[model samples]
Target: MSDWEPKIVSFLCNWCSYGAADLAGVGRMQYPSNIRVIRIPCTGRMDPKFALTALREGADAVWVSG
Candidate 1:
């Protein structure tokens, strides 16, 4: 079989997690290609539905960070 990579869905806060991700890009640091980022205004305002939806949509894992 070919290489199997996990699909990760990440919900990121616009002011925090998103910024960090951008900074990583600026620094030329590498993350796995499997990550999918969704930028939201704030983690406090994030709804449970999003994580559930990602899981249902076949994401191997979900990450939420502010």
Candidate 2:
């Protein structure tokens, strides 16, 4: 069997969490390549349906940051 990596969907707030992500990138931090990032205007605007959809679509994990 082929090795499988977990697929992660990350929802980050534009003002804060997005900057952390950017810094991680700029600092050349190592992270698994399977994570997919989605930038949102704010955590207050997050919809539960988005996480549900990500799970339904076969993402192994989901992360929400503000």
lDDT of 2 by residue, 23-56 (tens): 9999999987988999999998789999999999
Over 4 Å off in model 1, which ranges? none
**Candidate 2: pairs in clash:** none
The Cα error of candidate 2 at residue 47, in Å, is 1.0
Please give each candidate's TM-score. 0.91, 0.88
**Candidate 1 colliding pairs:** none
Q: Rate the local accuracy (lDDT) of all candidates.
A: 0.93, 0.93
Error of 2 at 55 (Å): 0.7
- Model 2 is weakest, by summed lDDT over 10 consecutive residues, at 1-10
Residue 49 shift from truth in candidate 1, angstroms: 1.1
